[model samples]
Target: MALRIRNHIPGLTAALTILSLAAVFAAVLGVIPQSSLPRAPEPLIELIPHINAIISTIAVMTILLGVRFIRHGSVRRHRAMMLTSVGLFIMFLILYLYKVILKGPAEFLGPDVIYQYIYMPTLAVHILLAIVCIPLLYYVALIALSRPIEAIYESRHKIVGRVAASLWLISFVLGNVVYVMLYVVY
Candidate 1:
């Protein structure tokens, strides 16, 4: 069964990644009509950024723990942690898109110097890594889901997983940093 799906992984990964990226861009760019979606309460909409910040923080910890677990040969624990991280990532994305589609991206209240020198650069790198991560993450996760633990070792899981995890951690951490710069800082 897993072997059958193995052959189609690349196709599946590409299709899903493209669709995911498209939906994200559509939402962010306002191509997705806000009137088409049900609206959340004002408070819930406002709380999404903070909620996603906490989710991103948890995802960072989970990615680190997942890597540590795998290194220590605790594959079951590692799988659990990694899957948890993915779940958190999904939750964060849904909440974020909802807010962005309804309310638009958050504005930075900091000074121009910080916005130009720090915020823009940080956001650019974070968005870049996040876009890069989508395919890598989908590949590794699909490989893991379609294969048994023993077979996963034979696939490109380790190499891809390492890259995905590294970029994923950096992306999530930078997301939290962006959150702070927007919501907490001047």
Candidate 2:
């Protein structure tokens, strides 16, 4: 059973990456009608950003811990931390999509120059990195799950994991910044 799952990792990763990207695109494009979905109470809707920011912060810590565990040669701990980070990310995504579907994207209320030059660019980079990170993350995760620790060391897992971790960390930080800009700053 493990061998079968291991053999299908690449295909599973690809399919998941595609589906994830498609879901994000659909949400961003507002292809899913907000009116059709059940709306959260106003209080819950208002709280989503704060919850997502907290989730992102936790994910950052988890990723950092995952890296530290790997550095200390604790493969099991590293795997656990990384998996926790992934789970947190999924939770963040679901909450984010639910909020967006219910409330739509928050408009920037800052000055035009700041919005155009700083906020928009930061958001764009954050989004691009996030989109790229999804597949890299899935690939690394699949590799780690499918192979023995020793076998993973012999594979591209290290290289890909490093890239994925870096991008994911940055994305989470930037996401927090975005939240602040949307909900706190402006």
Candidate 3:
């Protein structure tokens, strides 16, 4: 009889754990009243355009980290960056969705003229990318996690990793751009 082993990556579980926590936090926040919610820096809009600025900044950091990890040829770190980016976006999505679910989908900010064009595309693309990317992430995670040791890193993981990176970057960058246009520009 032979024992079987799966492919292993050192830090992926930890990254997932952190992401899970963020997701859970967002979900929890959704059902609770603001008075009952844990304190953060104030809610995003009340904090002003600075919140969008921060998310956009993190989006840039995620891209830079991802590119560096890929160029350096660290498959492990590359996966970490992608996972982290996805994790952050998950956090963003949870918050974004919570706000929408709680507050309704129309903007209460920016001038009417700019808000009209500004949000329509960003909102459509953000939503479309989200719908598409969720399934893609599931499959990519499956491809990464389902294989055995040698199969994990040197083979399927690379393909899945590339797909994950591209999808996540597009989603994240577009999300921030949408945020900027709505909050910062107009």
Candidate 4:
């Protein structure tokens, strides 16, 4: 396994929670402008979506490879994918927070009722759960690394797959939707 499965499940879970919350708090508190490097990279909104694309690709690969590994009973590769996906996600979050701090809040497309009711809720949930998923995602990955073969292939393990897929889908889809609205309509 690429990631060693900690027998101390509770401790690992708690550590994951703390890590995610710290990142969220950092995002919310607003990094000082001086903390950001001006010469590092100007915020390129156009290139940003590519990061999301990469993440979505990684997520897809992880899910597919994970399923395959389980079926074939290749524990190591499955563990690799799990670790790789989590690494990609953490990298995504760093870039995301950097982008957000560099630019500020999301650009709303419209103030209409439809935007308020439909768009806002979707966007809010997308962002919030994306943060929450940080820990859950890692936990799922660690489990895949640690769990027994029988458990790995079970429907129960698929629960983690479902959650990962749902969160990544919402994040990617809503991201594209918001991007389109901001750049095209608003």
Best by TM-score: 1
C-alpha positional error of residue 143 in candidate 3 after TM-score superposition, expressed in Å: 2.8
Write the residue-wise lDDT of candidate 1 on 2-69 in tens digits.
Answer: 77778899998999899999999999999999998999889989999999999999999999999999
Pairs with steric clashes in candidate 2 = none
Q: Tens digits of per-residue lDDT for model 2 on 1-186?
A: 657767887788889999999888888789888887888789999898899999999999999999999999999999999999999999999999888877778899999998999899989999999999998999898888777788888878899899999999999999999888888889
Model 2 Cα RMSD, 1 decimal:
1.3
Task: State the lDDT at 117 in candidate 3.
Answer: 76
TM accuracy, model 3: 0.61
Order the candidate numbers by lDDT, best to worst: 1, 2, 4, 3
Question: Which is better, 2 or 4, measured by TM-score?
Answer: 2
Task: Name the lDDT value of residue 19 in candidate 4.
Answer: 71
For lDDT, the strongest prediction is: 1
**lDDT of residue 40 for candidate 3:** 45
Worst 10 residues of 4 by lDDT: 31-40
Per-residue alpha-carbon lDDT of model 4 for 78-172, expressed as tens digits? 76776766677667666666666666656676868858887787778767867666666766766666776567666345686667756765675
Tell me the number of clashing residue pairs for each predicted model.
0, 0, 1, 0
Off by over 4 Å in 1: none
**Global lDDT of each candidate:** 0.94, 0.91, 0.59, 0.65
TM-score of each: 0.98, 0.95, 0.61, 0.69
The TM-score of predicted model 1 comes to: 0.98
